[model samples]
Target chain A: MTNLTSLTIRQALDGLKKKDFTATELTEAHIKASEAARHLNCYITETFDHARKQAKESDARYASGRAGLLDGVPIAMKDLYCTEGIQTTAASKILEGFKPPYESTVSGNMFRDGAVMLGKANLDEFAMGSSNTTSAYGNVINPWRSEAEPDKQLVPGGSSGGSAAAVAARIAMGATGTDTGGSIRQPAAFCGITGIKPTYGRCSRFGIIAFASSLDQAGPFARTVEDCALLLQSMAGYDPKDSTSVDRPVPEYFKAVGQSVKGLKVGVPKEYRVEGANPEILALWDKGVAMMKDAGAEIVDVSLPHTKYALQTYYVIAPAECSSNLARYDGVRFGLRENTDNGNLNDMYEATRNAGFGKEVKRRILIGTYVLSAGYYDAYYNKARRVRKLIWQDFINAYQKCDVLLTPTAPTPAFAIGENTADPVTMYLNDIFTIPASMAGMPGMSLPVGLSADGLPLGLQLLGKPFEEETVFKAAGALEKAANFTALPQSLMDKAA
Target chain B: MSIDINTVRKVAKLARIRTTDADAEVLSGELNNILSMIEQLNEVKTDGVEPMTSVIEMNLPARADEVTDGDMPDKILSCAPEKAAGFFVVPKVVE
Candidate 1:
């Protein structure tokens, strides 16, 4: 059998249906691949035992010809999702060794549909940093390397870095990711995989650890757009537990995967052409436009003037929401506690949070508190909130001109590790092109468009109107068929061998 | 606007996160850098624009008054740092 681990979710399902391989065999192959790829540090906790048991159950169901939608598929979950009786740290020491007694709505849905859990993938601490360097466990190294410097390690963009890395390396079939200010799409773009951040409230946020409530959303990362659509079909649904979860019925996402982009209006936002973006990325964006046009998509030039204010608006709003959401981590409840001798309540809260959170998390908390402070509220938080309306209005106006917007996913391909982590602002700028969609609560996707001269993958982002993920998927599927990106990291491919 | 050590310390206190004087000094520099970067938001004129609290623009839907969830304190308390008699143990506040 030619490397069962390399097959996409659809192919794996076909093999299982044909009885070519048992689900147990497929699960074991991925577990072995995951074991060999440990040097990448993509997973925080490997659920081999749990996966084996689930695979066995799936095999029995297959024998009886009673397979679920995602039966027998082995996948990774981003550590942000709460897996009952499994440690979900969100890659933060603050949540170290904390296992939820219940499953997150999205993960629970996947499990109910018979997806086997391979493990919990690592991410930035509290999903904060753009690079995976902020993970308390360790940085998840991108499997992709530039031709200029093969020895130099690159970041698998974050805070969904681990999920992106794992899927790219083929250690897991597909993985779940959350986007609060471009976490999912950015990492997927860097790792040369397909990922989508559904419009906010598409997936229930009931059990995912909160980073920024309003902007945070759970999505999927996969090697192919079809695989992402399959994973998202299971992950998205209405949940009474999460009040923000929309009551709309979940669409047949995979059905739209291969749908034609004929007569589709693809909007090219003029404002996304920033000054500092690499010429190679800009060229890839143009190629994406040409590909869409060839596929019968009308490439309309539209304007989103408020695009420039997205990063600043996101920095202020996400931190403010994070500051409020993370306040529950007092020494008393779940996770780590410190300073026992000091019987004072105030001292305990301070000691616990200070000892628990990492440097980046601490910085965000401080910035959030400062912006929302009594004196600075109107100057920073309120003003940013009002500007957020304008940013959303920019998209609302632009969508009226066309069906979807296309832009470069990031300014450049994956940069070397430790390249931008030194300066917090520089690190924040990594999501420059992707954050605007997140702020406006639109469904956005990233798929590989082409490779750079240095042999690194470049991705083009497609943004669709709210609750219109099928449009985004249809257009991206057309691009994926056109671009046909076939590069894989040689080192990880050798390791899998 | 530049953030000084005093400002960092004050915000840290308000956030209930412990920071030493040295940490405060370092944080002040870092916060100032981030603040200056985000200060660009002030440049965009948002006249007569209402602050958007939620993206969906819907009021919180009221539910009928009834018991929808609860009665599993054990599962909830299982994750507590310190628990006794089905209660999370915290440092005493009342003197």
Candidate 2:
């Protein structure tokens, strides 16, 4: 038999149903694969024993004819989500040893639906940086490397880098990721997988470690668009605990995966053709457009003029919200505390934060504080919010002309770990293609369409209107069928060994 | 307008994150770079646009403002670094 790890979630669930493989067998195969791929640094904490227990329970459910939607699926949980009794670090020293007393609504939903967690995946500390290099545990290695520099370590695009890497390496069938400014889609593109950031309010934010409250939304990473559909079906729903969670009915997304895209309007926004982007990436995007057109999707030229201001607007708004949201992490209720030995409250907060947070997080907190500070609030924060509304309006106007927008997931392929870390703005540019959709609260997805000149995977993005993930899934599925991308990161296991 | 080292220190203080003079100097340059890049938003004219509060077009969910669940002091304090007698211990605020 071939590798159980290589099978998609849909395939594995079918195999389990047919008795072709036991849940235990599937889980063990992935555990072995995870052990083999430890060099990727994909996980902050591996829950192998817990996974075995969950698989056993899943097998019991199968025997009892009470299987859930994602029965026996081995998946990676991004560490930002709190798991009761398990240390849920957002890959930061501040959250180093803190374990939540309750579960995040998203993970609880998945677990309730019979998904077995392999571990908490690593991410950018507090989900701050784009390259995954800001993680305190270590930068997650992209399973795919540039053909010219296989020995040079490459970053799995972040802040959802570890989840993307795990799915790409076949260590997990699917994984959860949070996208605030392309955290999921960019990393998925970098790691050669499919990831979606559902529209804002699609997934509840309860107990998920906050980054930028308004921008942050949880989604799934998988090898195939169908698998993402399956995982997202379980992960998304209205939760009373999260006020921002949309109270809309959860559609059976699996039904939408292979739904017809015949005559569907697919928008090609002109502004996304950022100057100085790689010619190869642009070429591949053209190929994606061609593939969709061939699949009978109506290709329409659309305008999203506010796109150029999106990154700057996101920089201001995200940090402003992040500053407000992260204010709870003082040396107080939970997480790390420094200078506890008779230090004043203010001193302890200052010391613990300075000692606990990494450079990037501190940089953001400072930036957020500055923008939201007195005299600067109207200048930076309010202006950015107004521009954010403009970005949203741009999507609204474009959606009038099309059902979904198509573009390159990232401007370029994955780069070496240290390549963009010297300057913060350069790292921020990685999200330019993915962030606009995030800002507008539209559902966006990335699916591998082609390889770059350097032989790394390049993905094409599909953005749908708010709560229109079903449309995004249909477009992505049509494109996926046309691209037929089946290439694996063949040498990743060899390096792991 | 780019930030200087003093602005960095002031922001750090406002953020309650202690920074040494050396770190502040370095952070000043990084913050200046980030802030300068963010300054591009000034180019866009947002004369009458309202600041966005939430992306989801929904009214603030109104529930009866009443206590839902409480009384597990042990569970709540379990995460507290310093706690005693069902109370979270903090530095002497009144001292």
Candidate 3:
């Protein structure tokens, strides 16, 4: 038989229905693949034992003709989700060894539909950095290596890096990811997979560790657009537990996949054509435009004037929210504690946070505290909030001219793990293309469209209006057919061998 | 305005993350770089715009402020680094 892990989530579901393979067999196959890919450091904690039990239960359900949507598909849960009795570190020493007594609403929904947990995937500490290097656990390596230099290790773009890498390597059928600033889509682009950050409040934030309250969103990563749709159907819903979660009916997302993009208005923002982007990436964007036009999508040029200021605005607002949200870690109720024997309360807090948080997390915290500090509040934080409105207005105006927006997911393909660490700003710039949509609370997706001259995957982003994910999926389905990306990471191919 | 070492030290203390003299010196330069990049926001004229409190249009819906969940102190304290008798232990503040 062909490798079980090589099958798409839909194909596996069909195979299980036909009794071609037991759910247990499929789960075991992915466990083996995960064990072999351990050096990629995709998971902070592997739940092999838990998976075996879940798969066995799924087999009984299949026998009883009561199988759930994801009946036995093993998948990775991004460690930011709080899983009961499972250690969920947000890839930070501050959260090290911390196990929540409750499950995040999204992850709980996945298990309710019978998705088996492979483990908690790693991410940037508190989901701070664009590259996964800020992870106190270790850097997540992208499965796709440059053809000329196989020994070089590229980053799986973050802060959702590990979830993307796990799916790209076929160790997990699909994985959950949270996007604060391009966390899901950028990594999906870097790792040659499909991912989406649904509109704000598409998925409940209950029990997921907070980064930035307004901008943070949960989404899915999968090998194909339809697979992402399937994963999202199980993961997204309104929950009273999360106040921001909208009370809307959940649509069957897969129904939107494979739909035609005929008569659709696709926008190409002139501002996204920025200076000094990779020429190959720009060429790929042109190819996407041509492909969409051929598929009957009207290509129109639109302007988002505030695009230039998005990164600057995000750097301020996100840090400000992160600073406020992370204040819960005070060596009082959770995770790591240090200098507790100190006679002073404030001294204990200083010592514990200083010792527990890694450099990047601490840096963001300092920045956040400074911006929200006494003298700088109106100058920095309030200014950023005002600018954020302008950025969102840009999208509101662009949607007036187009049904969907198309752009490159990243300025360049994945860089080597250590290449862009010279300055924090340099790393922050990696998410330039993906951040604007995030800032506006719009639903956006990234799918591998073509390979670069370096033989690494490049992706195009599809953005739709808020709560209008069906249109995004329709256009994505049309592009998936046109691009017909057939390449796989060399490492994944070798691992199967 | 660029942050100096003294500013970094002060802010780190406010964040409750202890910073040493050496760490503050290095962080001041890095923080300055980020702040200067953020300075670009000063150029955009948002004269009459309101600060963004919500990304989407919705009133802050308040739930019935009654007992929604509670009474599971063990569950809440499950991950506590240090706890005793249903409460998280903290350093003594009262002299």
Task: Pull out the clashing pairs in model 2.
Answer: none
lDDT digits (tens) for residues A273-304 of candidate 2? 98888999999999999999999999999999
The clash count of every prediction, one per candidate, is 0, 0, 0
DockQ of 1: 0.84
Q: Which runs of model 2 end up more than 4 angstroms from their true locations?
A: A340-342, A492-497
| Better structure of 1 and 3 per lDDT | 3
Misplaced by over 4 Å in model 1 are A493-497
Where does candidate 3 clash, by residue pair?
A: none
- TM-score of every candidate relative to the true structure: 0.98, 0.98, 0.99
lDDT of 1 by residue, A1-497 (tens): 86998899999999999999999999999999899889999999999999999999999999998899899999999999999999999998889999899899999999888999999999999999888999999989999998899899999999999999999999899999999988999999999999999999899999999999999999999999999999999999999888899989998888898898999999998899988778998899989999999999998999999989999999899999999999998978799898658688899989999999999999999999999989899999999999889989999999898999999998989999989867799889889898888888999999988888988888989999999999999998999999988888767656558
Q: Write the per-residue lDDT of candidate 3 for residues A9-123, one digit (tens) a residue.
A: 9999999989999999999999999999999999999999999999999999999999999999999999999999999999989888888898899999999999999999999
